[model samples]
Target: MLSEVTATRYVTPLREGGSLPGIVEADDLGTYVMKFTGAGQGRKTLVAEVICGELGRRLGLRVPELVTMQLDPVIGLSEPDQEVQELLKASGGLNLGMDYLPGSLGFDAKAYQVSSAEAGRVVWFDALINNVDRSWRNPNLLVWGGELWLIDHGATMIWHHNWPTAQVSAAKAYNASDHALAPFGPDIASAAAALAPLVTEELLTEVAAEVPDEWLVDEPGYATTDELRRAYVEPLLARAATIHERITLDAPAEDKPSQAPGWLSERLAPRPRATKNDKDGGQ
Candidate 1:
């Protein structure tokens, strides 16, 4: 379980996220961005946040510290919005909180640069988690203290939504064609070589244990919470070994950028199939 804190105040809702998480002051005198279990996406979103955020942190990636927040419904009484009040009331118990990084700016490729080595680690981690939200349109990355930090992992590991086919979903290829880091020429091969061996069953088990039992209870097909936790571990362990091989960064023509190095730009550029006439020595 994560470090626990009690919410002392609800400051305001962060409208940027679809799930409507809010800023809160906790009893520990720390400010955090709290995600409500009562949100439409439900507890599973927080579950994913804990597992992925913690896993990323353990892998030497920068991730905000996470804590389990205990919320009291009365705190929302001061809020005027009916929707927000209801949401707070419904989420009266445990929720998720991420330490707020003050004054952090959203990542902008034009203003900041990422080394190919760093970019490869990020892209490879995203692939391992099967993240669909790290595309250029919504990078979900922040630049804090002049370093990159990963956040908002609620949308990763989509296979959990359908347990019966989780293995099948985990085995599918990851298309990084629209990935925010595609232009940086991520060295996927090197990343896989360095990180794959570290993603052991032991580490994954530790990560899974961070997810509270409340979230795993009553999962449709699983009889026990431990069973549900194991379900998450198996797929990720399998994906880590080979996901880099299937990564595709063939960006669409419209999204292609001219800033990449010649080698990377050529690799990311879509190629046309050679016609028979052209193949025959330009006959």
Candidate 2:
């Protein structure tokens, strides 16, 4: 279970996304980026964050610490934003909170160079979870302490939205052409050899358990939260075995044929070591 903290102060809204997640100070004196149950995406978004974020951590990926925040609607009474106030009023209990990374820079690919091995691992992990949000336009990645940290996993596991066809969706191929790490010539073969065996039933079961019961309560078609959890674990376990083969890294047709080959080859070509001051291209 995630550590729990009561929100002491709502600092400000991060208007970057539609969910309207905000920065808040907790009673434990820690700062977190809190995502609300009342946000348009609802508790399911929080569930995805926990499952994918924690799983990524266990798989040796860097992700900010996550906690369950106990929010009191009254904290928003002083807020001038009517929408935020209403959101708080509606989300008066448990919400998801990620430890705030101070002085983090958004990832900028053009400036920072990612090695093929690192890019392969990230692309493989994203494929396993069926994350559709980690695209070039909105990378949802940050650079803090000279490391890449993944965030905003609420867009993962789209099949969870419709249980009936989830199995079919789970079997579908992952199109990595638009993935943020695709340009780096991800070594999918190497990544699969290293990571696929790690995505076991036991591992996924443990990951699913990290999701708060409150978020899983009364999910349709499942009599209990544990049962609903199995629904999440099964697909991932099956997908992990063969997702590498299904990953399509082909460049999109919009790119001119001549330019696409040159661009990909250039990015993949061996280059001099990148300097520490080089830019990271993810925001």
lDDT of each: 0.90, 0.89
Q: For candidate 1, give the lDDT.
A: 0.90
Any idea what lDDT model 2 has? Answer: 0.89
Per-residue accuracy of model 2 over 26-96 as CA lDDT, tens digit each = 99999999999999998999999999999999999999999999999999999999999999999999999
Write candidate 1's Cα lDDT for 1-283 as tens digits. Answer: 6999999999999988998999999999999999999999999889899999999999999999999999999999989999899999999999999999999999877666888899899999999999999877788989999999999999999999998999899999998877887778888899999899999999999999999898889999999999999999999999999999998877346445422223345554689999998889887
TM-score of each: 0.90, 0.90
Off by over 4 Å in 1: 255-283
Clashing pairs in 1: none
Least accurate 10 contiguous residues by lDDT in model 1 = 254-263
Counting clashing residue pairs in each candidate, in order, gives 0, 8
In candidate 2, stretches whose alpha carbon ends up further than 4 angstroms from where it belongs are 252-283
Clash count for candidate 1 is 0
